[model samples]
Target: MAAVSVKASKGWQKPPTRLYEDNYGFGINFYQPMIDYLDAKEEKRAPKEYPHLPWSNERGLERYSSKKLVKAYSEKDLRRLVEARTKADHGAFTLTKPKTHLSLTETTSAVSAINRKGSTKEEVRVKKMSDDVFDDNMEQLASALRSAKAYAIGKSAKAIESHLLAESLRNLSSNTEVDIRSFQRRAEVSSHDSREHEWFMEQRKMKEEELEQLTQPLDQLKVELLGKQTSIEIEQLNSRVVEAETRLKTEVTRIKKKLHIQITELEMSLDVANKNNIELQKTIKKQSLTLTELQAHYDEVQRQLQVTLDQYGIAQRRLQSLTAEVEEIRGNYEQALRIKKSVEIQLEESVSRINELTVINVNLSSSKSKIEQELSVLASDYDEVTRELRVSDERFQRVQVELKHTVEVLHEEQERIVKIDAIKKSLEIEVKNLSVRLEEVEANAIVGGKRIISKLESRVSREVVSKTKISIPYSLKVSEEKYRHPPRWRNWSTC
Candidate 1:
């Protein structure tokens, strides 16, 4: 074993300096402290037996003790190990290299402990860890503490002052002296209530001035109305004066002329009355002849009235006879109408029967036409066969005899077909049961057709899918680089 020593001249001041001896082995404990202690052993010294845990054996402890193998990771332990490693380099042979991607998690049987938080229970747990593990955990804790200290130191003075100020304010508010008068003054000033009140007073003054001005216009209008009323009263007085003056002037003029004109007009009226008397005398003589003519015309009108009454009596008698004849004719007409209706109904029925017969005839004609067509075809065949038969008349005669015998047999078969049809009808009535089943049968025919179409479509889809399995991807990839192999089960093994 080669040895390393951590000297004390440096700052490390924990325990006494000890030798590090290499017993770096793997798959067993790699502690080095036991190894170094064992190396310090002399021949006179009896061997000291220690704990025999898995990591405390001679080989395990040696490897654990060696600075190269033992993973001591605290700042103190690591600094010691580094020095020991440097010293070890001076005296050592080969040493195992550190793993490149070694994780704290991957190192078992090596220091992998981390510091628990500072709680009573956590301290107890941390205290129970192995020395190497405890060292690593302490080193990590000390590093974290340093980082926390550095972070605390990095804060600005202003930030500290702000925090302190906020805390002081919170404390101050706990026992504050509030003066509502100050707050109310600030509220009233910010609200601008006094300025608003002054503005309101100014607006009210302006409105009062405007109201006074408006009332002045109303007074002006009232004065104008008074003037108009006074002018109207004066005009009424003037009209009354003019009426009185005109009335007096007309009265004087009438008094002077009224007597003189009245006398002259009376004389003229007598002359006119004499002239009217002469004219009326001539008119009366002329009207007397016209009145006599009118009397004669009145007698002629009365005679005509009498003649009309006699004619009316004759017409009334004739009308009575005509009415009697018309009543008889009405009775006959009613009978004729009924007969006409009966004839019309019969005609309609006959026409319907004719149409039915015509349709039947058309159907029969079509059947006959079909029979004629068959006969024509048979005749053509017969003509051809007749020629062939003429060529072999004896064979044809034998076939004719056979056909006659076959016709007789067909006659018997037709009778049997009739019997079978009766039996089938009887069986259908029992087996089909309900009359409603006929509708179901018809519906089934329609469903059967639809099902047939669906089945064909399914078959076509299966065919399309089958063909697409090979062709679809090829068609899609037509513009791409050609595949080295087409789709095959060999390449699709994973799929």
Candidate 2:
């Protein structure tokens, strides 16, 4: 049985070190106690100096044994030993030999029998000495028996513990294996999903780029249309301005020509009137002279003198009408000169107005150019803004898609987590059932006294259980953390 335990312990030692080193990469010191326990178990005999155990004295058991000062084992000591043995079975260190108690008891009993057989001559001294030695020996024997009983009890208890621990470890190992397989499956599915998501994102990006390429020419066309319309409007305005200028020039020239013709006509009529007045004056002068000569011959003929006086009066009336006509001609000439001067002033005013109109036209043209420039700038700005809006809209859509993807991923992870939780519950139920079975095994092991063989097996089982305790929850926590947060692409939604 001891050889089996040693072999089992040796076999168990390598796995934990390898498992921990490969999977967790923990330092070997973490399992140093187990290594030391295995080492102690493999030895054929106890070491002269045993390693410190909780039940042993700090100075060591060998010191007490060598000095013959070993005290009788007390109930408390036995209890402590039992507890320590229980701890040892659960991966703590313990050392014992099945022969020590028996050998010591036999030697003491044989020495007492030899002393009791001494002759009567030395009876008193021998009896006193033997009595003292015998009392000490008896005490030692009693202590050894009690220790043996305690060892047997502790051995039974340890066996039960080992059996229970082994059962629990077996269940835990099976459950952990299942969990690991499920986790690996989940990892594979998540990887496939991630790859699909990446491919979809690339496709979306490509489509967005294509849309931008197609829209470029359309935006350019819109800009060109706007420019053409503005140019057309500018040309129409320029044409209207040119037509108005020409009309004003034609009207000014026509008015100046009409004024010039009217002044010349008036001047010609004045000249003809002046010439008629000169001729009439000459005729009147000649008539006056004829009258004077007729007066001289009046004395010769009284009837002829009366005839001459009538003719003189008629000629004087004619002269008076001629003077009035000459004066009217002078007044009309003055009015014609006044009209000419007014027309000259009006022509000068029209010329100044034309110049102002030309300046206004130039200014209007400049303003039209400025307006065209502004319209071009506005069109460009509109195109830019539209392009930016389109890009933003595409980004928003992409973010929406990403958000949906993330949400779906989270949902799937949550479903998987729920499944994992269900598995965990089932494992817990199985563990409970195993614990019940272990308790039954413990009862049977105790009744049957088959505890000694289970020492190393218990240690190995407890170690396995401990490793599972550390590793499984950590993996679950990592998976949970990975799925808890959303993806990085969701940041674009804020934009």
Per-candidate local distance difference test: 0.45, 0.45
Residue pairs with backbone atoms closer than 3 Å in model 2 (clashes): none
- Give the poorly placed runs of model 1, Cα more than 4 Å off: 1-299, 377-495
Candidate number achieving the greatest TM-score relative to the actual structure: 1
lDDT for 53 in candidate 2 is 36
TM-score of 2: 0.15
Write model 1 residue lDDT over 1-495, tens digit each, in one string: 546766676666676565644333432253344555565574334357643445344543543443444344776667567546444433321111121323222222123244334476433422332233434433443443344335434354344334333533432342112212222333344355677556545644664475455545434543454345434534543465456557766986896588668768877887898888788878887888888898899999999999999999999999999999999999977766665565445446544644553454355345434432332323222333223323333432443354355345435534554243344344334323422342343344345434544554565566565654635453444313113223321221211
- Angstrom error of the Cα, residue 358, model 2: value is 2.0
Estimate the TM-score of every prediction.
0.18, 0.15
Task: Report the error of model 1 at residue 438, Å.
Answer: 35
C-alpha-based local distance difference test score of model 2: 0.45
* True lDDT of residue 371, candidate 2: 34
**Clash totals for all candidate models:** 9, 0
